[model samples]
Target: MAEEFRLRSVAAVAYGPATLFGLAEGAILPVIALSAIDRGATTAIAALVGALIGIGSLVTNIPAGVLATRVGERRSMLLAAAVTVAGLVICLVQAGSGPWALVLYGAGVLLIGMASSVYSLARQTYLTEMVPPHMRARALSTLGGTMRVGLFAGPFAGAGAMHLWGLPGAYCVGLVAIAAAAVLVYRAPELELTAEHRAAAASITTRDMIKRRWRTYVTLGSGVLLLSAIRQARQTVIPLWAAHLGLSPTTSSIIYGVAGAIDALTFYPAGKVMDRYGRRWVAVPSTIVLGASFVLMPLTGGAVSLALAGMVMGFGNGIGSGIVMTLGADVSPAIGRPTHIGIWNELADIGTGIGPVILSAVTALAGLGPGIIVSGVVGFGAAATLWTYIPRSGALRQARAECHD
Candidate 1:
């Protein structure tokens, strides 16, 4: 329990930058979309802003993983912090005209995503080492919940900073958060690699490692695909629908903020479920809620309706996402934990990046309601599989096997 508590502290410190930047990053998206439009970009180009960031993450994930393994988790985190800090500095300093700003934005987002991958992988590796397997889901759930709290709090700060100081302020906010995160991480005690862990790490090459961990890799990718599709509807299309229905951006921000809060609050109980019942038990309901939220979106008629939709959607996202995150870390081999977890979340980055583009097309062709409905239905289908594959009994068996091995 003490070890779990320590792991939790590390996770909280590690996740702080993400929380701060998530707020700034999300706020900047709408601004970027609007700016691209203002700069005479077509809808296609505007959406490219996000796409470029995803591409950057895809390009960087593997290397980031490898690098973390080579450097050790603490050093990797420091490097990640430096890279993110640099990107934020660039955005803050280079807020100029033309495609150059786009380039800088893409660069910053890419670095952030890359750093995110490394930080996440290292954090997972560190946690796995500290916390016992049975407590893992609960610990990870706590981490997931913390992340949601960041998500919940970040946007409001971003919006406020943007309102008070414009894009530069938002960027500054992210920069400060990144810097603060660095300070927190640096202050925390570092985890060192022992000789056995090092030998285990060294015995496997990247290609060999992937082959061995493909089960986890495949699961991560499939989960990402499902979540990405759902997130597209929720983050991009749902908000657009809200705007079209005459809600102010502030109101929309509030809706998102509230949902994030709900997500944060739910993490503990969800983690408890995963701890007691197993990962799949908690994950199944989460994915279903995520899907159901989209299905329920069209029913929202006013601010009250929108808020309700947001709350439901947020709950689903919060619950479902926690399971996936915890399990991804759970199934990964100890030797290649960083590399494996990095690859797992890179899929998430890819899904997030491509989400807006795909959903935009759906919204253009079929109207937001139909598009969102499809997303929800897809989520339901994805959620249905968890029961079969990840039952509590199965997970228990697997956990026992892992322990024995």
Candidate 2:
């Protein structure tokens, strides 16, 4: 079963589109706030703009999943890419148009966020339905790794574009990348659902499905939410901390890029460990390490030390690649996979959206160091929750046992 589910041509086709989408997303993410800043928004407002992506994702998550079920994964992805392109065009047209530019750019970012939610849901549903259970972790982990590779490469690409054509040019790169992804997805082989799978999916309403799985979704899903919050906080806090430390933008970018490289390198091994050992093996350590990195951030007095902390955090993040997705897949009912994933991702996006807001508010009330320390505490709390709840084996075992009974 594992051999049959390995990275075959079909998987590669899905991955190709994902890779391009990731690259596009990665190129824009690190710079959205900076772009807003350049357009004359205050730091707080700029951060809000960055957070809008998550907000948009939150709003669209369930709808995106429903759309995927109705239209099929391929068509949903294509529609998402098209919407993303429209957003990019708006950003490009309004570049450097002063305050109005901020509004337009924010709108563009929101649209892209909507598109991303759809794209991600489509791909995740595809993998969950197509890949066998035994190989699911590795396949999803590889998907995570591919996205990291794009993210690792994106900042550098944005930097170049910024140097040459300023911030809006980075959006141009994203536009082009997503366009290519759409083309690839269009050309990929169609995913056909088995008759039984279709019947199962058709029998359940999204609301009914959520009601049935509320226990696992709320209990285990809370852990996923906190983990996502910590991850978002890391992304938010790092650059702000670097600025506080008086590091050059160039230096900060390099440090983040290096950390991303470490993250990308570890995805496959982490997947292997999850598949061979258990999800807990990777989950516990990753959460703890990430928390430790946040706790240690204030201790770093210089760029070198900060980089080290980033590297440690990145390593932690790397080891848990696709973990949230894997767990969602594990517990999701086959009949309502898309709807379950939608709810799972919505909870996670809420965390992502709120993390930066919390950081910003905390930093304003106390200080940057203290704000980050608070985030660290949250991470520790999440780790504790996972340790208590995430099963020794994958959640699939429990899910299967319940189905059998």
Candidate 3:
């Protein structure tokens, strides 16, 4: 039965698209704030532009999940890729121009965010259905790792593109990668739902599912929100830190790219540990590591120190590749799973959106160092919450209750 699952086929067909899409996103994401800054946006405004991606995701998540359920994952992905291409085109066209250039670029980013939410929902839902429970973490972690591979490669690629054609050229790289992903999805083999899935789909509306599962959603979702916030804060803070330290654009990208590579290394091990020991094994350490990195970032005096801090944070992040997605999948009901996942994603996106704004505001008010320290404090708080609330197992939960008694 395990052999029949053919994980390889799924990886080849489904995750292939993810690899390309990740590469595209990775190429552009590191540059979004930089591009906005080049166009005369203040640090706060540029961070806001970067946050638009998360804002877009927050808005479209539920809709994207519903769309995936109605149209199927492959079709949804194809549609998302098309929209992403269009967004890229708009950004490219509006690059470095009139007074409205930043506005137009932000609009384009918003569109891309919408497209990404759809694509991510489709992929997550499809993988949940395809892989068996015992190996689910590993499968999803590999999926996350594959994307990281693209992310690891992308900055170097973006650097090359930036050198050859400048900022607009980075968008072009994403456009091409997403276009290729679309083509790959079109050619990939089909994934058919079982009778069980179809029946579950018919019985519950997305809204109904959420209403029934609100408690679980809120509990787990809070953790997800914090996890995502710290992750996004890392992304936003690192670049801003480099800029604050007066690092060159090329040097900043290299630091981020190298950090991504570090992040890519631990996905498989994280999965293994989670499967064998439980979620806390990976979750606690990841959060703590990230928190430590953020707290220590401001103390660093040079680019090398900053790079080391970034890599330490990357290591934490790498081990948590598919953790939020994995936890969401573990808790979601079979009925209306996509909708639940969408809601889960929405909470995460909210954190992603809020992180940058918080960092920016704090940076403006206090200092960049203080802003990062706040993120670190939040990370430690998240870790404590996860440790307290997330059960090790049914038996463990019982044991804890007995201990309290």
For model 3, residues 149-173, the per-residue Cα lDDT tens digits are 8877776688799999998888988
lDDT by residue (1-405, candidate 2, tens digit) is: 546446764555567777788888888987888878877789999989987887789899998878877777788888999999998887676456478889988998899989999999889888776776667788788888888788777767776887898877688789878888888888876678666766666567778878898888778888888899999888766778899999999898788877878888999888778888878888879989999999999999999999999999999999999998888888777666787788889988877767777777888999999999988887887788888878676655845753673
RMSD of each: 3.1, 2.7, 4.9
lDDT of 1 by residue, 258-353 (tens): 776776677677767777777767767777888877788887888888788888887877766556566666666667667776777666666676
Question: Over 4 Å off in model 3, which ranges?
Answer: 1-5, 30-48, 94-96, 99-105, 194-196, 199-203, 242-252, 391-405
Error of 2 at 292 (Å): 1.0
Q: Which run of 10 residues does model 3 get worst, by summed lDDT?
A: 394-403
Residue pairs with clashing backbones, model 2: none
* TM-score for each of the candidates: 0.86, 0.90, 0.87
What TM-score number comes out for model 2? 0.90
Best by TM-score: 2
| Clash number by candidate, in order | 0, 0, 0
Q: Which stretches of candidate 2 lie over 4 Å from their true place?
A: 1-5, 34-44, 95-102, 162-164, 194-196, 199-203, 395-405
Assess candidate 3 and give its TM-score to the true structure: 0.87
